[model samples]
Target: MTSSGFEALLEAVRGPASVNVLVITGAGISLASGIPTFRGTDPGAVWSNEVMEKGTHAFFQRAPHESWKMYLQRFELARAAKPNAAHRALVAWEAWQEAQGRGFAVVTQNVDSLHEDAGSRQLVKVHGSLRLARCSAQGCELGAPRGTVPMASVDFSAFHASPSPETVPRCPRCDSRLRPHVLWFDENYTEHDTYEIERTLILARQSRVIVFVGTSFSVGVTELVYRRGRKLDARMFSIDPSNASLDRGIEPVTARAEEALPELVRVLQS
Candidate 1:
């Protein structure tokens, strides 16, 4: 049986059509891979009032050690988790869309690199990535001023940030702290060159169909996609087991993305 979510996908994207489809995803898509959802009622969700307070740039400045200790753990968790069926499904869908000469892109809000691991093309990580880290100050080896390092090349085995800020990761030139490459609570998407906000909006504007998978729609990028897709009269669908309510012709498809997405692509293939 085809899911109502895929039903919408199939309806919006028939055979041999040049439809431009945009996929927006969030933490829920990574749940099957042993990651927890952010906004859900799950006991393991990463955010809270306290967490939100600590997730800001100011908090990192105030206490870099505590911030590094917490967020590096998140990076390690993300590194350990593997891509699940949902991620593979999107990769397949992208490949299929490419074969058909259609436009497709996936804008993921996850800090994890699951989409890249699953081989998805035209992928955008709007919230930054855990696979990367950068120096907080000017004139470093990574970037000219804010050099970045792939986590693989970095050891930091003795990773300690407790007794002294000097003990934490530091820039070679400026001796400033190095931070995780994730978007912070108080930072705008445009602050860092890593976030491809303009590219995301352009995709949203060009999309004839926009499908949001497992997101809570509480972020700025989500709102931008919603508004842009609406302006283009895009066929919108949200797939989540919670069946979260949506407005402006966006249909809610109550299902888990891991289960729903493969089925969605399977039907589209058939």
Candidate 2:
């Protein structure tokens, strides 16, 4: 981010008597840790139109193996990757917030568990974790009405981009098929228990500052939060490397998460 831009954003946050903070993240935050983003012309992006198309429940029902094939490779990458400086920066910020007896929370779209590992509490993983699995038969009583999150049982250690029928993951309960515990391209945030969509929206509405980290308002969750923030007049900041439009009323800090977040912690701690 430009020094002036960064200073402007920092000043806004510091100047405000803002009482609550809401941080929203996406794949860009994990990019430094070697996980790829989902879209755009980036050659290393994990999903293409066809791959994203395969992320639907209908596609899963028709070809469970293919769906798993797409997810498993990404999960494998997420498994091996470590949290980068940006994740730790947020952890530090959260610690500061706690000491001040102020409200702070993260609502991340990333399926990776890096934020949890980095010790962020009061977090809502709007897109479920790749570290978990659930039954394919919706309303399976394994976890009951809400469908409990179970550790991913299907061994994906040997997984590659091409999975066979025998490689399809199965639910430990009911011996039914297991699907990745992630919100699919076709699914709404309300469809699952883990998303905590309603609670997140409420928090966004309540926040005095809403930081958009690594996401560019591409999905429903971001849109909802943006609308609420507009109504509430939240001091919003957007941290990103891309030239995302500035029409959203969010003060822009145009830099990658890894490069910008440590600086953010420094300024806040000072």
Best by lDDT: 1
What stretches of model 2 exceed 4 Å from their correct place?
16-18, 143-145, 155-163
Task: Provide the TM-score for each candidate, comma-separated.
Answer: 0.92, 0.91
With a 3 Å backbone cut-off (N, CA, C), the pairs that clash in candidate 2 are: none
Worst 10 residues of 1 by lDDT: 138-147
| Best prediction by TM-score | 1
**Candidate 1 lDDT (Cα, whole model)?**
0.82
RMSD of each: 2.2, 2.5
Model 1 Cα displacement at 65 (Å)? 0.8
Error of 2 at 218 (Å): 1.1
**What lDDT tens digits, residue by residue, belong to model 2 across residues 1-270?**
456668876766565455788899988899888888886456687666576678788898888887887777787789999999999999998887777777889999999989989889889999888887777776786432267545644565444443766666566667677777888889888878678999999999888888888886788899999999999888888888774677767888889888888897787898
| Candidate 1 pairs with clashing backbones | 139-145, 142-147, 143-147
* RMSD of candidate 1 to true structure, Å: 2.2
